[model samples]
Target: MEIVKGSGFIPGDLLSKINSPSDLKKLNEDQLEQISSELRQYIIDLVSVKGGHFGASLGVVELTVALHYIFNTPYDQLVWDVGHQAYGHKILTGRRDNFHTNRVYKGLSGFPKRSESEYDTFGVGHSSTSISAALGMAVASKYKNLKDKQHIAVIGDGAMTAGLAFEGLNHAGVENANLLVVLNDNCMSIDPNVGALKEYLTDITTSHTYNKAKDKVWELLGKISKFGPNAQEIASKIENAVKTSLLKQSNLFESLKFRYFGPVDGHDVVRLTKVLADLKDIPGPKILHILTKKGKGYKFSEEGNETVWHSPGLFNKDTGEIIKVIPKTPQPPKYQDVFGHTIVELAEKNLNIVGITPAMPSGCSLNIMMKAMPDRAFDVGIAEQHAVTFSGGLASQGLVPFCNIYSSFMQRAYDQVIHDVALQNLKVIFCLDRGGLAGADGPTHHGAYDIAYFRCIPKMIVSAPMNEEELRNLMYTAQLDEVKTAFSIRYPRGQGVMVDWKTPFKKIEIGKGRKIKDGKELAILSLGHPGNLVTEAIERLKEQGINAAHYDMRFAKPIDEALLHEVFTSYTKIITVEDGCIIGGMGSAVLEFMADKNYSARVVRLGIPDNFIEHGEQVELYEECGFSPKKIAETAIEILKENKQTILKQGGTSLHDKQA
Candidate 1:
C-alpha cells in the first residue's frame, strides 16, 4: 500500500498538474481530454484499493472534467445528483491528495459533502434531488442578482426519471430559471433503469428522423437570424412552430418548457466542454442529454456485470478479479443475501406473495427472487413514493406484497407509508434493508430513523430480526392472513452471526420477545442485530463477576410489554440498546413504556445519538457511538460500580430497591 502511494501515485499523473477548476482551465481541449483519461485511471487505481462507488464515477469522468473546465465551479453552484458519480469531481476539486482515503473511517466521504468543499454546493447520496437543489440555488442567485453564477445539476438518466426531478423541471420551466440539467444518460442507476422515461429517452436517441428534422429546423432558424430585428422575431415564431411540431414526437424536456440540447458524446471531454460553454449564453431551464458508457475506460468494469462493479470492494485493476478479504473461519452471508434467499424460499410456497424493489433489485439481492419469479417480482425504478402505493395496490387484492427498500431510501416515501398503506390498513410488508449505520456510504445512507419513523405511525408494526433465521420467520409471519396491518422488518447491512443461518422456519409470535440469559442486578434489552453485540458484552461482563440478564426484544413497535413488566420488576438497572437514533427509537419506546407503567427503574439508553453519524466500518461506528461489545461491557461495569457506590454511600440500604 505504501509502495503504491509513495511510488509517484500523483506526481507522474496528469491530475497532479490539475488541483482545482482553475488548473483545468489552464489546459487546452486536448490536454483536458488527456487529463480525463488520467482521471479515469486514477479513479480505477484508487477505488480498486479503497472500494467506493465504481461504475457511476467511471461513467462520469469526462463529464466531470468537462463541467469543471467549462464552468467556474465553487464560484458557480454545481450540484451533483446521487453524488456517487462525483469521484472525478472530488479529485478535480482539490481532493486528489485525500482521494485514496475515500470512504475510510475519518477520511474523505464517498459522496459530495458541502462542509468538505465549497465546490460541493449540495451534499447528496440519494438520487433525483439535484434538479430541485440546483434550481433552488439558481433561484437564490437570480433573487440576489448574481446572473453570472451558473447553477448546473449533473444528474444521471436514472435520476432524471425520478418524480422529484420532473417536479423541479416543471417549476424551473415555469419560473424560467437559469438552471442547466445535464442528463448523463448511461441507461443505468445501480440496476438498469426501467419505466416510460428510459424508453422515451432511448426512442429519441435512436430516431434519425427526429434528429434530422430538429437539426433542419435549427438551421432555418439560424439563417433567419441573419436578416434583421423583424426577421429575428419572425425566425423565433417560425422556430417555435417548427420545433413544436418536430419535438412533440421526440422531446419531453421541451414539453416541460426546457430548451433540450444533446444526445452528445459525453466521453469526448472537448465536445462536452464546448456544448457546456455554448449553453452558458442560453437562458431558461435547459437539459443537455449526453451519452456515456457506464464503465467507459476499464474493460473489466465495462464487460463484467455493471451492477456488481457499481460498488464492488477491493479488486485487481488489471485482472478485474475482486479481492475478497477472507476470515480464518467461514463467514456468514450478507443480510441482503439472507433476505433475498428467504424471500425466494417463502415466495416459492406462497403463490400470492410478490416482491417489489424501487430500482434496487441487485442492491437488495431481490434479483435472486426476480430471476426465480420474473412476473411476480417487480423493479419500480427510482420511485420510492410510487413503490409504497403500488405495494398498497398489490395488497388491496388478496396478494401479499413484500416491498423491499433500503432504510434511507424508504424515508423518501414516508407520506405514502402513512396515507397509502397505513391509513388504508393495507397488509404490505416493507423489508427495509440497511437499517443501521450504513458504513462507508455515510449519514445519507444510514438507516438511523426507520425505527423512530415507522413505530410512531398508527397500525404500523415494526420488527427487526436479530439473525438470518429470525428474519425468515418474520417474513413468513408477516404474510399470514391474520396480520392485517402494515408490517416493517428492518435489518442491517453486511453479515449476520449465524453461519448455518438456514434454520427451519417457525412461526414467531408477534410483539413477543425471548430471554437470552437470567442474571441479577441489571437487565439488558436489545433490539435487532445490536443484540449480537449486547450478548457479547454480557459474556465479557460475566468474567468480571457481573451477571447481566439479556432480552432480545425483536419488535420495536408493539414491544414486549409482558417482558418489560418482568424486567422492570426483577431488575433495578435496565439498559436498552438499539442500532437506531436514540431520540424516538427503540430505547425511547422502552422509556415511554416504563413511564406509562410507572416503573421507576434507572434506564440507560445506548444507541446512536440525535446527531447524524458519518461513514466508517459498522463495528468502528458502533464503538464510537458506544454500542459495540467493548463499549457496552465498559458501560455495564460503570453502571455496576455506580450502583455499588450508591449502596456504599447509602450505608448498605440499596437505593435501587428504595426507588422501586
Candidate 2:
C-alpha cells in the first residue's frame, strides 16, 4: 500500500499505503489499529481547516476501517445512511488525496455519489435509506447467482428509528438474500435521538442478558462456518439458543426474521474485524448492533457539545476553538433563528400554538422553543411522514402546529401533506427551512422543489418571505383563525437582510404582494429571499439607465391577482425569479396568470433549472443556476438588448409607447 498524498496531515511513518480497500487488505491485521488512529487524525486535520461534518465521521473511524478491511468493496457492495460518517469511508476508498476538497465547489461530494466513484454503491444524503438501497443490491445479487457477493448497510441508531429502516428490515427478513445490516448505535442524529425506539435500543444495550449471552452467541456463530453444509442449521440452533435472554427482549430485528447479533464495542477495530469476518460466513439476513460514541478519539470533540461539533465550520484544531467571523457591526441573524425566536413569541400569546420538527431541533433552530417552552415544542425522530400527519392531528383537534421540515426532506412526506393536511384543510403552518439551494449538502439536501410541489395542492397556502420581517408576518398570518387551509412559509438557509429584525409581529393580508418600486421599461417579480437579490440587480440596472420595476410577490398560490393586473397591463417585458425550480414555480404561476387574463408579454423565468445541482457555496450555486444578482442583471440586460432589436423591426415602436 502506497501513500496517496493529501494537502493536510498524513502520518509519515504509518498509513503510507492505504490507497483503497484492496490496498488496505495487503496490510497485516495487527496494523489495523495504527491505520484507524491515523485515519481519525487525518479527518480532524482536514475538517478543521476545509470544513465539513465532524464528530459523526470521527465516531465511525474504527468501524469504517474494520468494514473495508473485511468486505471486498467495489465488488461486495456497501451503502451508507445520511453520509455524515462517510468522510473516513471516502478517505479509505482512494479519496485520501481528494479529502481536502470534500464539499467544495466542483470537488468531491460530501455525501456518497455514484457518479464520482465505483465504491459508492448508492448516492446518499438523507437518513434511513441505507437498508432499502442495500437490500435492493442484495436481492439483485441473489437473482444473478453472485454467491460470494456480500451486501452491507452501515446505518446509525438514529436512522434505525425511521419508518423506512423498519420497512426494509421487514422485507429483508422474508427474502433469502446475503445481507448484513450493521447498526452503528451512537445515540444521535445531528441532535441526540428521541422516541420509543431510543429507549428500546437502550434497553437491549443495558440488559444483563445481552451482555452475558453475547460471547456464547458469537462462539456458536464462530463454529457455524466450520460446519460447512450444515452452517444454516447451526446458525438456527445458535439463534434459538439465545432466544430466551437476548431474543426475548430484543425481538425488534429478530421478529423481522433478521438474525440479531451484538451490542459490541465499535471502537475495538480488531474485535470489529473478527466479528465482521465471522458474520460473513453465516448470514441470510442479520443485524450487528455495535455501540459507539458520536465523537471518539479527539479530546475536544469528545468534550464539546455534540450538536455544535457536528459541523463546526473552520476550527482551530490545536486550540479546540471554533472560528467565527466577528462582525464590527451588529449584522442580521439567520432566517432559521428568526423562525425559532418568533415561534416562542407567538406561542406565549396563543395557548393553541405548538411546534414540531423531524429530529432537526438544532439544525432548524427549533431548539429555541424547546428550551423556552418544552411542552409546546416536540422533536419527532427522523420521520418526515409522521411529522406531517402528527401536525395534521394537532390541527384537527383545534391546536395550531408549526411543523418545521427542510425543503428537500419534505419531498418524502408529500402524500401525507396532500391527504392528511391539505385534503382535510387543516391549519398546519409548515416552516420550511433551507427552502432553496442548501449549500455543501448538494442535490439531496437542496430545498429547490418545495415551491413547485406545494403550488398545485388544493386548499394549500404557499408563501415565501423576502426578509426576517416578512417571515415573522407570514407566521403571524398563517396561525390566525381567519386563515383557512394548510400554510407553507419557505425561507433560505442563511441570514436575512435586516439587522434589527425583531420588529412587532404584524399580520400580512394573505396573497397580497407589495411593490418595491415601479418602472416603465420592464418589471422583475421575485419570491422569498431571492427578492433581496432582485433589489441588488435593480441597482445595477439603474446605472445602465434601464429602469426595472421590482415586486416582492409574497404568495405563490392565490398569487396577488391585483398586483398581476398592474404588472401585465403596464409592461410588455417581465422577469420572474425564485430560489426554487423554474418548472411550475412562482415564475410559472405568473405566466399562467398572464395567459388567463389575455395579457401578452415576453416572460422570462429564472431559477433552478431542470437538473440536480452539485455541492458548492450558495453564491456559486446561485450563479450556476443563473439567479445570482450578477446573473439576474445579465438576464435583464440581454432582454433589453433583444427588445431594442424588436423596437427597430416593428416600425420603431418604443416600450413606453407599447405599454401606453
In order, the Cα lDDT scores of the candidates are 0.87, 0.91
Residue 635 error, candidate 1, Å: 0.7
Q: Could you give candidate 2's per-residue lDDT for residues 1-660 as a string of tens digits?
A: 444455645643456577789888987888989999998988888899999999999999999999999999989999998798899999889888887888899999999999989999999899999998999999999999998999999999899878899899999999969999999998998999999999998998888867787887777777776888888788788778887656687887878888888888999999898889888987599899999998899889899898888999999999999999899999999999999999999999998999999999998899999999999899999999999999999999999999999999999999999999999989999999999999998999899999999999997899999999999999999989898789999998988999999899889998999999999789999999999999999999999998999999999997999999999888888999999999999999999998898999999999999999998999999999999999999999998888889887886886587556
Best by lDDT: 2
lDDT per residue, candidate 1, 57-170, as tens digits?
Answer: 999988998888878888888999899999999988888877877899998999999899998899899999999999999999899989888889989988876789989998
Q: Lowest lDDT 10-mer window, candidate 1? A: 1-10
lDDT of 2 at 243: 74
Off by over 4 Å in 1: 1-8, 11-13, 211-246, 326-328, 655-660
TM-score of 1: 0.95
| Pairs that collide, model 2 | 1-17, 2-17, 3-16
Q: What residue runs in model 2 are displaced by over 4 Å at the alpha carbon? A: 1-8, 226-231, 658-660
